[model samples]
Target: MTTNAIVTTPAIQRLATARAAVVKAAAAAQAAHDAHSNLLVKLADAQARADESLSDFRSGKIDEATSALRKAIADADAKDLQKMINDSAENLAQLNDASNGAMLAEANAKVAELYEQRVEEGSRLEAIISEIESKLLDAVVERYRVQAEIDPDSLKWMKIYKPSPALDELVRRGRVPGF
Candidate 1:
């Protein structure tokens, strides 16, 4: 109804929409952070086991056993170590891929949400313009109704500003010229 209200409605709507989008993006980032954290724990455990096995071999623990049995356990432990490394490598790769995917998805979602906001802002601005136009029409009608009581010049009131076609185009595109 009022000029300020008409001008601010679009801004308020845009702010609400942007806030929701930010919350969603933050939640996705947090999930990715937790997944990486879990992978780090697994990696640390694997590293500890590998280090302990290497220390035993370096300290002559293997030399104390009969050569055949020593060779067997050493081979088995080597295989175990290799398997652990392979598993860790695979897990790390998977973790990297997952985190990368999450980041990409979050970026894409945020971009999509921002575009949606642009559309919403454009629509809200259109509504505000419509409201202003309607209010101006009402004022004009009231002035005409009081034609006999008031001088035509004395009834002059503020006029509505025309919609900015360029601004509408810019907002729709979400950027300035050449972008």
Candidate 2:
């Protein structure tokens, strides 16, 4: 019986372990993201139900029961947001912990394989996060632009105007009039 030395290396074992760990972590993160999406849907549904209750109450279709249910739904939505935030926080912590372990495994594993997997997964998640951030920024900018077109005071509140210190100095120096 001939034993192949190439198949028994400690480095090979570590590389296999690292690959498994990376796959597991990605699966966990995907699951958490799915859960977050589900919670968001639930929160939206609760909000919609609350709105319906308010409309019914306003229309006199129901009594205090509608207001009570609306309040309960609002509370549930708030709790759902908190739960989503907590879940994200916990998942991030777990990812951080797993990453640290994976780094340790890299020392014992095939460097190229470890590095390649890490970079691929990191870049994939980074792309997802970047897309989400861009969407959020676009929405905020759109909202601000619309508000500016409607009411300039919203922009003023957002401090998108000239610096306060410079304006203050100008006002103090009588270069500008105080309104």
Best by lDDT: 2
Q: What is the C-alpha lDDT of each candidate?
A: 0.61, 0.73
lDDT by residue for model 2 over 134-155, one digit each (tens)? 8966776777788788977667
**Candidate 2 regions off by >4 Å?**
1-6, 96-108, 112-179
Question: Where does model 1 exceed 4 Å of error?
Answer: 1-68, 144-149, 152-179
Q: Record all residue pairs in model 2 with backbone atoms less than 3 Å apart, i.e. clashing.
A: none
C-alpha lDDT (0 to 100) for residue 105 of candidate 2: 71
**Model 1 residue-pair collision total:** 0
